[model samples]
Target: MNIIACIKQVPDTNEVRIDQKTGTLIREGVPSIINPDDKNALEEALRLKDKYEDAKVTVLTMGPPQAEVALKEALAMGADEAILLSDRAFAGADTWATSTTLAGAIKRLGNFDIIFCGRQAIDGDTAQVGPQIAERLDLPQITYVEDLEIDGNTAIAHRAVEDGHYIVKTEMPVVLTAIGELNEPRYPSIKGIYEAFREKEIKVWSLDDIIVDTSQIGLKGSPTQVKRSFTPATKSAGEMLEGSTQDKVRDLIVRLKERQII
Candidate 1:
């Protein structure tokens, strides 16, 4: 079984700060980590690999050269191979363009039995890339998968919905978007880390290497335009009533009456 796990390096939200003047993220000094949910996807792929003797897990990502760090981490977590898609032409790509590029890369890789991806990336939170990639590749997809079971060529997935989960069964060569509840991601071993840094080679591919429409890449292919981005105003302080409980209740009633809220 050939498993492909898609991941993205995102800024650690806890340390991220917003530029008030520009209404944008201040990424200059922010440290990046693998998207949390993508780690779950990778963990699931690794578990499947553990089950199948011939399973090969390939970690793939589309980002700047720095994203190679994320691939290295995946390698340390037991992925058989890593591939990085980095090119100036892929810069400023929205979900559609990103999915298009990934789908093209997957086609070039060929012979994948399963493709796993996170439910969404923290920075974007659009939750569109995985489904879009599935569409572009013309493959069956199950999103928001919390649990999965594989039997021969058939895959049984538990998908979370509004009220409950649905059990979906499908064949091989399917795409699955994993949520955090799926599994606990394992940490990289010391030996694996050393191998990742010294022995494993992360193959880098450019836009020229993958087959995709030139016009439908980067900022040009992105259709969603942000009109504005700003932090919400801080809430005003609440009023304090001084006196007995009865007095406080009376004052509160009067205040509510004055505001026509009573």
Candidate 2:
């Protein structure tokens, strides 16, 4: 079985800061880590690799040259191979264009039993890339997967919803977007890290290397335009009501009534 896991290198949110004047992320000094949910997806792939004797897990990502760090991390966690898609033409791609590029790369990979991705990327919470890739590939997709199992060529997954989860079954060559509840990612072992850096090679691909339409990639291919990026205004502090229980209750009622919220 061939399991492909898609991951992204995102800025550590806790350390992220916005430039007050520019209203843009201050990434100069921020550290990058694998997107939290994508880590869960990779973990699930690793677990499956452990379960099937013929299973081989391959980790893939599209980012700058530095993004190879995330793939190395995946190899350190037991992925058999890693692929990086990097090219200047791929810059400023929105979800649609991004999915188009990824779909092209997946096609180049030839054969695959399953493709796993995170439900959403922290940087862009659109949550559209996975499904878009599925659509482009004309493959079935199951999102918000909390649990999953495989039987021969069939995949059984628990798809999370607002009220509960729904059981879904699909054939091989399907896409799945994993949520955090799926599994906990394992830490990289010292020996694994050494091998990943020394023995494993991260194959890099450019736009020309993959099959894709010239007009459907990079900034020119993006349909949506970001007119501006800015931070929201800071919220004001809430008022504190001072009085006895009855008095406070009466005051709250009056406030609610004045605001037409009662």
Candidate 3:
């Protein structure tokens, strides 16, 4: 069995900055790390690789050159191979454009038993890329997967829902968006880090290699456009009522009544 895991690098919350003019994130010179949810997905893929005798896990990521750091981290964790999709044309991509680019990269990878990705990217916060890739590839997709077992050509999985979880059965080559409930990610050991640092055969693909039309990629292909963004307004001054419990309760009730909340 062969498993493909999609990973992404996102801005560290503390260092995040939005471009005021574009309303998009400013990724340059910012602290970046792998998306937290994708770590769970990586753990799940590594577990499957361990269980299967001949299975191989491949980690792929789409972003600028900076994103190669995230793929290297995946390699240090235990992925058999790593692929980085980087190009100037891939900037400012929305979910749909991103899925298209990733699917194209997957096509280049050829055969695969299963595809795994995190539930969503923290930066975008829209859980659409996985399902969108499934649609583009005409493959089955299971989102919010908490657990999975591969049996021959079938995959038996547990998916999370609004109220509870549901067991699902799907064929091989299915795409799964893993939830954080899957498993905990492991830290890279000394030996693993050494191996990752020494490994010389990393696959890097550019837009030209993938034959992505210039017009159909990057900002041009993205349907969603951001107008502008600004810092939120500051809080206004407010009164603080501190007194006896009875007096405070009465005042609160009167305020609620005045606001027609009661």
C-alpha lDDT values of all predictions = 0.95, 0.93, 0.87
The TM-score leader among the candidates is 1
Q: Candidate 1's residue-wise lDDT over 4-116, tens digit each?
A: 99999999987877887776789898999999999999999999999999999999999999999999999999999999999999998999899999999999999999999
Arranged by TM-score with the best first, the candidates are 1, 2, 3
Error of 3 at 243 (Å): 8.8
Please say which candidate is ahead in lDDT: 2 or 3.
Answer: 2
For each of the candidates, the C-alpha root-mean-square deviation to the true structure, in angstroms, is: 2.6, 2.4, 2.6
Error of 3 at 53 (Å): 1.9
The Cα error of candidate 3 at residue 124, in Å, is 0.8
Which is the leading candidate under lDDT?
1
Model 1 misplaced regions, further than 4 Å: 20-22, 236-261
Ranking by lDDT: 1, 2, 3
Q: State in Å the error of residue 154, model 1.
A: 0.8
The candidate, 1 or 3, that scores higher on lDDT is 1
- Angstrom error of the Cα, residue 217, model 1: value is 0.8
TM-score for each of the candidates: 0.91, 0.90, 0.88
Clashing residue pairs in candidate 1 are none
